[model samples]
Target: MTSSLPLLLLALCSLSAAEAQLTVFNLRASDLPSGIVVTTDGYVKVFCGSASLGETSVRNNDPNPWWEEKFTYFQGQENDVLRLEVHDSDIFFNDLLGVCQRQINFMREHDCFLESGGLLHYSYTLNGNNQ
Candidate 1:
């Protein structure tokens, strides 16, 4: 086993790590409930595993919120899964409205349906990781 140690080191050193970027496009939602408020102040908190990509701005007083905001993360893997959480913003604490998750893909759009009865219209692009 000791004789092959040098060869193993050479092989390991030759491997190149892949780097990619993930871009989350605009998001739109419908039927979001008001959480202890007169209207629903909705926003999105994005995550890939423990890393937070970014979030959109809060859209106030609307059951249907359309945020034409985009967020980007530079260290995305093709096998990585994303957690898209919809929340109702408030003064003290933010209320979770819905959640949906999906594996990274090379598709053009992702029409996600939140588990708590709503529609999420968003898309993403993964670039520079060989698709």
Candidate 2:
């Protein structure tokens, strides 16, 4: 019985470790444009577009318009890579703002957004380390 207990504990520990290592990739965007391919490693490469400016142009009046901020998330598994891209849409700024608002509301509802926290901080966490 004592030996069986040790084995059971070991099994439980292994199970917990597996669960802890299971990571999920989530991409929330208001719109996903066509002809966009997402890789496993999170590198967003634009294959084709109407204009070759690297990103969507916000101001058509300007000859040299600025590119919209492109957001992506990726995970690697040995030689395999998984990536997701949230391309900037025509109304990207507004969409991003809406996402931020929703996040703030969620944090507030969970009591995680404390007054002392001072203007909700957001940073990326990659490979078990905060970036």
TM-score of 1: 0.79
Per-residue lDDT tens digits for candidate 1, residues 23-124, read 888788988765463888889988986799778899989889999888788888787888789988888998888887888876657667766557777888
Range of the 10 consecutive residues with the lowest summed lDDT in candidate 2: 103-112
For residues 96-123, could you state the per-residue lDDT of candidate 2 as single tens digits?
1111212111121111131211111222
Residue 42 miss distance in model 1 (angstroms):
0.1
- Please provide TM-scores, in order, for all candidate models, with all chains considered together: 0.79, 0.22
Cα lDDT of candidate 1 equals 0.80
Clashes of 1: 0
Best by lDDT: 1
